[model samples]
Target: MDNKEYIASGILELYVAGSLSEKENEEVSALIQENPELLAEVISIEKAIVQLTAAAKKDATYSFNDIKNQLKDTETKVITFPKPNRKQYIGWAAAFILGSTLLLSVLQNNSLKEQLSAEKQQLEEQINKSSNSLADAEKLIEVFRDKDIISIPLAGQTVSPTSYAKVYWDKKTNSIYLDAKGLPEPPEGKVYQVWSLTLDPLTPTSLGVLDTFTADVNKIFTISNANQSEAFGITLEPAGGSLSPNLEQLYTLGAVAS
Candidate 1:
């Protein structure tokens, strides 16, 4: 018969429980020694009965003595029973569960740590933005504190109706801070130059080139004007600026009122 039919006969469970005769046990052992599949099926059934017997007892251990003592037969087996690995199996199972729990906890902690790191980075960025805003306000306050600064507002000219400029000229210190935020950029290879003008002869003195006009974040240019200037005008000149002003390229003009 097949291993299934042999196992379904219920003889293997009886043999494992020591309920079979001596002759039947020898016959079953001989068949298991020849057929590996039959031996496997018999061992599976035997394991179930062994587990049930082990649970019925209060003690946590079962050695070969226990198996032989359960047989209670004079001619049951020619060989001794194998030692039970009850303690070792229970220890390994407990260790496996503990290791699995520890690994899961570590993975969960790493996920939380990554989330915290992202939140901390976002908070740092927010703090930096607020600090930069405060620094800008403080810088503006310092810029407006000069006592010798003469404020001059230049309106839009015919060339650029939207252009405007504010000049903070410290005549006593010979320094002028020009705010050209409202002005449009000059064409390629051209730059704006500041002219300190005299009203009587309409003569112009070159202060300096308004370099980095577009690059300045505040759009405020600080220049030195040592001349006795009555008016100021902005003209687009070549890259390095000219020795004098070009009226044709004049963008805006305003007189320094007394």
Candidate 2:
């Protein structure tokens, strides 16, 4: 047979897989030595098998020389038969190896698809989170630029001389955005409380408590306030917040412009 016809017959694949009889193996080995093309084809088949085995068994190691040695070391059993068709035996062996290799390829492809799907989902979630944060920041910038919105700077008090905060009061919406980025995290079992103050009688109304201070990424909070606030104050209080402000624990205070 010509080189192309012999290679296409699939006997070389069975030879590389160590499925041929002793006499057949000797004949193939002699042919391989005489023809470089046949030797190259055998090496190519061995390499493909090594790659597939290595991918399926990630922790295992394989080498071309190992497969070559296994081919030489294979022992063929001589079974007594009235009339054994050597061609039929070799063809069946080649078909079985090809089917197994195809099955392995399919399984590996499925595993890769599942892994890619999970990674794509995680990437999409991260993108959505970043987009929402950007939208909120844009809205805040617009509010700060409004003509009716009040901007109040609360300076540090005696309790925390280096701390400061800012209040952006949207009176039309009765909402205030508090930027408490300058303040330190409160101690355990304690929280920061915001108060709207009236200076005439010095009456203080609790706006809300910063219960999520440590967990807030930007140190910014939104609170609803409908009181006629003449001033703003922040003080450290117990976990659930107090009905009244603690003057001694005041961290920052500011007066609203008339």
Candidate 3:
């Protein structure tokens, strides 16, 4: 609204350039009618531009009419540029379509590859689980094999007659699978120790103590027995079992028939 602010806004320069928007042109026209001083200032600036442009145009020597005549022949000469024929344009269109289709196909192939990888991993996990189940079943089958296995039935002693155990002695492997299905778990801090007894001298050799006695689901233990013995017995002495069978704590006794 102020005279100094209006001149500094550069809107007047655009008005002189004939570049002001239609709404701006009408507003400036209204302002010129109201402000005589602003109107006089615009006339003086326009006159100076007219004089400067005329002088510059005179020095150029090329008249606008001569330039017009030169432009008149421009269309007559018809300077042709090399452009693709219709076939070439069609070929380019086909190539662009093919390229886009190929790119889409590659992305779809990659997605399918990822899906196949996930399926392969799933199949591998399933196979591993199946293999484990098969191995466990095979182990159960081997435990009951009649050949090369001496089954020693351990009858419960006077202390507990209901508690029975079967020792499947594998002489070839020097190992025995003691199935203590009928035996009750010993009290806390106590374990059952096994012994190999020779009938003649009554000499005894200590085998390993049963581990995980309470938590064993099948209550079957595979123990090493490289001894030439006649009888087997189990005794509950302490948590780690005893060096010698606690005669007082003997639970079960069984003899191997000759």
lDDT of each: 0.83, 0.93, 0.83
lDDT of 3 by residue, 35-138 (tens): 87778878877888788778776455666887774675444434233465766686776777688779979998998999999999999999999999789768
Lowest lDDT sum, 10 consecutive residues, model 3, at 73-82
For every model shown, the clashing-pair count is 0, 0, 0
Q: Model 1 off-target regions past 4 Å?
A: 1-129, 141-147
What pairs collide in candidate 3? none
lDDT of 2 by residue, 209-235 (tens): 999999999998989999999999999
Q: Is candidate 2 or candidate 3 better by lDDT?
A: 2
Error of 2 at 157 (Å): 0.6
Q: Estimate each model's TM-score.
A: 0.50, 0.65, 0.50
User: Candidates 1 and 2: which is better by TM-score?
Assistant: 2
What lDDT would candidate 1 get against the real structure?
0.83
Positional deviation of 86 in candidate 2, in angstroms? 7.7
Q: Write the per-residue lDDT of candidate 1 for residues 164-211, one digit (tens) a residue.
A: 898888877688888898889888899999888998988999989887
Over 4 Å off in model 3, which ranges? 1-134
